[model samples]
Target: MGKTIAEKILSNHSGRDTKAGDIVIADLDFMIGQDGTSGVAIDSFRKMEAKKVADPSKIAIIIDHSSPSPNEGVSAIHKKIREFCLEQGVKLYDVGCGVCHQITPEQGLVVPGNLVIGADSHTCTYGAINVFSTGIGSTDLAAGMISGKLWFKVPETMKVNFNGQLPNGVYSKDLVLAFIGQIGADGATYLALEIGGQAINEMSVDARFTISNMAIECGAKAGLMEADNKVMEWVITHSKKKPNPQVADKDAAYKQVVEIDVTKLEPQIAKPHTVDNVCGVTEVAGTPVQQGFIGTCTNGRLEDFQVAAKILRGKKVKDSCRLIIAPASKDILMAMIKDGTYQSLLESGALAVTPGCGPCVGTHNGVPSDGENVISTANRNFLGRMGNRNAFIYLGSPATVAASMIEGQITDPRKYL
Candidate 1:
């Protein structure tokens, strides 16, 4: 069988012939939505005259975008979601829980060998655990809500084999950036990238997420790494057990292969307004920073905190810069507090925000002022991504972002390491 992880997951769910570019609407195991735009999906649902969600038990609604303190509009949306969930008998979470994907595994919403779909583009982030999850539009969400089935065109697979151990200060973010820089933004359009190799096997799951979360930026349908010991450790440590998700069959099919030699990589930076606009951190060095942030679904894991906490252990941020850090999940937050990581950051004058999609979605918490320039650990820096349309945004690793806060300019993370 020509089977990628996604293919294997989909076949188990719907059991249909799936060739590249074939659209098949199959029953899904899970569906999710969040505070920022989930209301839009719910609104569209009312228009369909579908009284109840297709399978409310399988539906999960999370409120996090404007979470810590939702504005009047977002609050109203939250109330509606509560009503919808109550009426339809679905599961719901308040702001306290954290980002959807983080809590999903924590709550055991994702299981081994399941085909999951979410309403947000970063839905692919769940692929870190071998779940076949992808992003879809709100309209598609509402349709899936009515019928447990969703459609997808089987994507061609690209094998990205990363070999060699990474040198100090070279992050998974750098590796992903270097790959996309070589492939261009649309190089993997309508394609699935199967990332594996010695270097990848050596990486932590948090590092894998940093790579996979930005897969959509490359225009890839989805990006994934073969599940391995690191993946098993993640599920065991977080979910309290191993999931044993199915892997691609030994003879499963792949379309193409790409390779990365991590030993040669250095810190990478994505220039403002487009993820595809890329260069080395040295290219933008000394670009003064007014804001520095180190949280997002892409880089807000506990491992990320270990990087930033070390950089800011005994130092203060530049007088002109505002640095904000948020854990991706409340569980992570609690763990950090217990481990004194929060104190390390607080002592250094780094502000803490609630766990959610903060700043990255331009909704609330930690927004930058107009015309301000900031270096962040976020996945994208498109126009107006952080609040003000004209504000300058630079994307980098957590270490580099923390270093920039200390120096008040874009400093290479290698300096701190």
Candidate 2:
């Protein structure tokens, strides 16, 4: 029997054959922790009484969440991380660097077929480029940091094939929302999602990153995309080393297969409270919104910003609504500035914040007021996700968020496009 991408990557890293449900100890190419989780991992590492990290170069600590120190408590945590990295010789990304998932790939730290783990749930974002990446708790992260190896239960694969071209005003975010709606929130619990097809292959690496970033929200172990020329080009541009692309065999075993025709798809929104509580844009049109946000690891790439700029140019954000734009990373923000997208957004009454998680994690910047409704491009929409238990968050694509920002309500993106 042939092996799926997850199985093959696990096998290669474990130095043994692997398949679904197999418990294997695999060597890690990289391990990451952000401010929110790294402190716990550090405590655990200290409790273990290890003198040195197994490989300092393989471990990275980022200060993204609560970046720039929202309060003294967060500042102390940042201080601890900086001190630990300095003492241990581990790579450290300071505040304003961006979300860990975005910076990890942008810095060329990830490569195809690499087995990566992080304390952040969205670590699976690396899988966008064919890496076998997943999230773990602080203790597990500490163990991986101390030993450079971690145990994993190989998961069964689910194959999702996207056929046909995506319609105008639709995006990878809409497709992912529609998919999550079909499968429900826990539909693929702990399963490896191997996503491909003409639509995925045709998508840019940034779009693929958006898709993979949300795999965790769907209750997936990881999301893997086949590494093709586009991925190779991205890797080459980001890193001096070339990737040895991994492709699933034709007969690879899959627990289930889902085929989606993108041509018939429309803009999708995950209504308040649950990511799986989805509906087409038209179904919820005219729903009032007090705020709109377009940023996060899931949809804060340059392409996303460009889409927002295209829609907001020469127009003003609704007077009743507040629009906030955050680029995923410093590079993306710089790119937007160079291309005048930032200026267009600013002129249209949108506020551009620093390149970081920014309101997505509810730490700081753009938190909603009580009883407010927000349309955002972030992945999750659970209650209190944006700092207030009473505020509601609606998830949509960038175009959808931008259109809704202009209308001060939930509106279909096609109208603006």
Candidate 3:
């Protein structure tokens, strides 16, 4: 049987010629840690009595979720990880360098066809450009750090065959949210998703990133898109060279297949508390919003900001709302400044936040107060995922967020698009 791109990558990294159903310990190329559980992971390794890391340089320690420190426990955890990374010669990216996953790709770490594991579930986001990436528990990640090998269950692959043009205001987030909602949260558990077809070709790298980033949330092992010239070009523009790109073979089999036609879609929203609890924005028209955010590892890239900036330029946010923009990386931040997108957003009254995962993980600046409602482009609307449970969160694309900020209500972006 022909192997999918994900299967091929896994086989190559297994240090053996792997076959389906063959269990192997795969060598890891890169690993990442965040503020949440990385501290415990490092501590657990420390308790192992002089266990040395396989390669410290390949480890990336990031302080994002606890950016400004949500509380005493999280703040201390961030401090411990920072000190441990510094002491162990592990590369660290503190707040202001932007979300770890977003900056990791931009910083030239998440190349294609590599097995990159992280402590956070969203680590699967790196699969967008053909890398076979996923998240593991702290203990597993710590073990991988020392041994440079990780284990997988060899998930069955599912092919998503999307066809037709996406309607205006129906961006990548919309397609993915709809797909996962229809499939249910646990539908793809322990499975690899092979995304392809005309719709995948139309979506940009950032948009693809958005889709792959949320795959893990649906319990999928990883959501992968075949790498083509578009991905190759983005790789060239962002880095010196590209790694091997992989795609599923013509006769490769999938566990299941789904076809999505985005031609007549509208802006959709994942209501508070659950990503799968989705509905068209029109269904929530009277829903009021007090804040709008347009940045995250998922949607904080330069392209995402440009879309929001275009809509908000020469316009003003309503009095009831506070708009915030935090680019995904320092490189993206610099580009937006160079292109004057920053100024346009500022002129339109959006608050310029640091180049970090601000508010995305409910850590640093932009926390919403009780009874406040937030419309954000960040992934996940889980309770307390954005700071406080008392505050409500609505997840949408950048267009809907910016449009809502202008209208101060849950208005569909298609009206403006």
Candidate 4:
């Protein structure tokens, strides 16, 4: 009868003994909204006759999608968000501040054992640091904004153990893709994924974030990682709040258990139209590509850029291909510049966009033309994911994207390593 991490966190928030299938009204540590959704949330807030946010400090409004005012319509949304945040005394991250998923963690707005909700589906990204974060619709976002509380049905945990060292050029992205491909898109519906084991324990925080960021792709409620020293150190450095970390008890039960050995795992790719339509890199080798994108909430961290820079150094992007680089945040972009990662990528014919969602949301920035193929590090390959339903999207790791940018096709990343 031991409680999993999710149960323990919910119990703490709700002041009740909680478990899977139980519904609870819990206090939230943080709530977030982005330009794409915040305007609607603001409208909902006003419609509810809510005068003030329960806690302005805990609520954040970020303008990332359609950033820099892609068009007049989006510009009005940006203006509305800015005015709402300013009037409510809420924190606002304007254009170029980075994606909400990346900046929330970067700014230490989330911490271990915290219950968080955002209007964006990738809010599960915070689970890399052991926070119980999930996505909600704009209406739910407004409710949390006004009350600082939300209801939840505690989710059963799914334990995924990753052992063995990841081979060079094969990354956490590949490992997660392989898992998603195995489980299919709806496999973990409404389940909290607890990812751990030797490989995950050894991965850098940035890489771990990539895995958690895509948990939603498999229909997971949230992706949780153990708050080991590495995660603790990250939270300590980034977060001002004292950590209240939690780990699942040894006897805690899981709805399912999956084991993956990464010693020989290869670079994975998710073919167009679905994230779970995946295959080994060799399965689709030599597939022509017109774009190679290496940024998004999923893989726009500093580590991803370093890998891309290393691969593109002393080489050039294919003449027929366009390589687009986007850093996850202004901080990551600055770090890349200090270390020459930015320069390396640019010299190799890669075009650097603002440190935001870029073409991943299909708003502006780097959309591809009709009938083109794009190898990207972003999660999701659903039709029109990159702005055009006619263009195909292939999901891969940063190294895989970089390697493919050179060859103008789907090439194995190990070839560059």
Candidate 5:
């Protein structure tokens, strides 16, 4: 009986031979707390009466959601987080730094074969680099901060194999959306999603990051990929840390195995109020849209910007539609600016937003109007996801978003591609 990557990593951290369903207290390699949720964590830390964090270097506090302080209350919370970080000497990433998930990997805080946790659901994004990362509650985050360890009920691995070339307009977002549609919202509940195959192996690190970032949307504990040369090289070039990519055993057990050939896959979209309520773009083509958003932790990388730029280079957004572009990080924003992508988007009538979570969390930046339809690259489309329950959110790839924004309706990106 061989072990899956999840089991292997947990075993290494727990100092024992572990497997699915096993209870183990594993040492955390890194931990994160973000502004949206860390306030409660800070309060809990005080309630626990801990003198100091177990290891300040191992922990990071990010202010992304509601960044720049959308209101006075949030400003006070930011003030508290800043004061606490200064007092405790813990690393703090203030507003404009970037989304926690994006900046953590960009800064090399996430690496393969490490067990990491964050107070945010999208913490699973780190698993793209072959790390065993997942989300924790505020109290659990506090506990990890204090003791530097957390217990886990090891999850069974669900293997998803993607073979064949992705169609020109079909990107990683479409693949993940199609997978979620097949599996349903709670399909992979508490299961580790190990994605691989020809398509995945050929995907860029940015693509892998997008796929892994949305694992939480489908109830996955973590979405992992085997680190290949691209991942190894990226991690090395980005951080001072050495890479130790993890691999599943040859005969590792999987709770379920799904094989998908993306050769003929089409652009996919997730309809309002649920991520799994997905369908091909054509299914809902010509559906009018009032706004379009092209950024988030899920799809706010430089690659995403490049794709949008390619589609909107010589076009402008529909007069009836408002478009917003938010790079995931300041670094990505700078990259877009240096490469002329930012100028192209601006000239195309897209409004520029700071590099942070911004409108993705519905806190500020670009919320939709009542009864409006918004096509976005951000993950999740539940009611009120973009600051108003009355507004509808439709999730799609950057190409789809860009094309639809130009047409003022949901349109297939294949035409633009």
Candidate 6:
């Protein structure tokens, strides 16, 4: 029988054949930890009494979350991470550099057909480029750091195929939100999501990154899309490295298959308090919002900024709403500035913050007040995700958030487009 992309990648790394439900020890191309989790990992490494990392070059330590030190406690944590990286010779991306997910690919640290593990759940974001990446706990991360190998129980694959062209005002965020709604929050727990079809093929690498980044919100172990010509081109342009994109066998086994026609879809929103609590934009249109955010690993790319700029040009954000824009990485921030996207956003009354995971975890930047309503492009809308337990967060595409910012309420992006 043929093997799915996940199985094929795992099998290759394990030096043996692997299939669904198989347990194997696999070598990792990268082991990543961010400020939020790296401290724990470092402590665990010391507990294990390891003197040196298995491979310093293969380890990535990022200080993105709570960047710039939200408080003295976080600042001390950052200091420790910096000290550890210096002593261990591990690559460190300091505050304001960018989120780990965005920088990892932008810097060529992650590539096609490679296996990566990170202490952050969104590590699955790397799968956008056809890598087998997943999240692990601090202890597991420590083990991977010390030994450069980790055990895995291969997951069953769920194939999600997208067909037709996406309609105007719709985006990968909408499509993925619709899929998550259909499958429910726990629909694909611990299963590999094999995303494909004509629509996915036509999407840019940035768009694919959005889909893969959100797969974890639907309880997926990992989300994958077979790398195509576009992916190879992106790899070359960004990293100057030629890529060997992986492919699933022609008859790859899938536990289930889902088909979506993108042409008929509309902009989607995941209402406050739950990622799967989704509805078409029309359903929640006109609901009041107090804040708007556009950035995060999920939607903080250049394309996302372009869409927001196009919608906000020559218009000011609503007086009642506050809008904050954060670029995913320093490179993306610089690109936006050079392209005038940043100016347009600022002219429209948006505040541009540092390139980091600000406000996404409620550490700082745009946390909402009690009982306030927020519309953001970031993935996940769980209660208290953006600071206050009483404040509500609604997740949407960049266009949707921009349009709603202008209106100070939820509005269908089609109207603005």
For each predicted model, how many residue pairs clash, with residues at least 3 apart or on different chains? 1, 0, 0, 0, 0, 0
- In the range 165-194, model 5's lDDT, one tens digit per residue, is 887889999999999999999999999999
* CA lDDT of each prediction against the hidden true structure: 0.81, 0.92, 0.84, 0.93, 0.93, 0.92
lDDT of 1 by residue, 1-417 (tens): 657777766666668766666677788888998876578888888898888787887789888777866578777888888888888898998886788867776677876566777888887876767767788888788888888888888787777888899889888888888888778788888888777777778888878887888788887877776667777766766654336486666777777778778887888888888787888889899999999888888888888888898988888988898888878889889988999998898888898888887787888876788888978888889889877898989999998998898899999878887
Clashing pairs in 4: none
Q: Which ten residues in a row have the lowest lDDT in candidate 2?
A: 238-247
Weakest lDDT window of 10 consecutive positions for candidate 6: 236-245
Model 1 pairs in collision:
3-253
Runs with alpha carbons beyond 4 Å of true place in candidate 2: none
Q: Would you give me the overall lDDT of model 5?
A: 0.93
State how far residue 137 of model 4 sits from its true place (Å).
0.4
Give lDDT: candidate 3, residue 213. 91
lDDT, candidate 6, at 290 = 94
Measured over all alpha carbons after superposition, the RMSD of each candidate to the real structure, in angstroms, is 1.9, 0.8, 1.7, 0.7, 0.7, 0.9
Tens digits of per-residue lDDT, candidate 2, 200-264, equal: 98889999998898888889999999888899889988976556678899899999999998999
lDDT of 4 by residue, 212-275 (tens): 9999999999999989999998998998997799999999999999999999888999999899
**Could you tell me every candidate's TM-score relative to the true structure?**
0.95, 0.99, 0.95, 0.99, 0.99, 0.99
Task: Give lDDT: candidate 1, residue 393.
Answer: 91
TM-score, predicted candidate 2 vs. hidden true structure: 0.99
lDDT of 3 by residue, 101-194 (tens): 8977777787778788999898888788888889888988888888888887666788887789887668888888888778878878888898
Kindly report which residue pairs in candidate 5 clash with one another: none
Better of 1 and 2 by TM-score: 2
- Candidate 6 per-residue C-alpha lDDT over 1-417 given as tens digits, one digit per residue, 9 for 90 to 100: 999999999998999988999999999988899999999999999999999999998999989999888799999899989999999999999999999999999999988988999999999998989989999999999999899999999999999999999899999999999999999999999899999888898889999999999999889989999888888888877775445577888898999999988898999999988999999999999999999999999999999999999999999899999999989999999999899999999999999888999799998998899999999999988899988899999999999999999999999989888
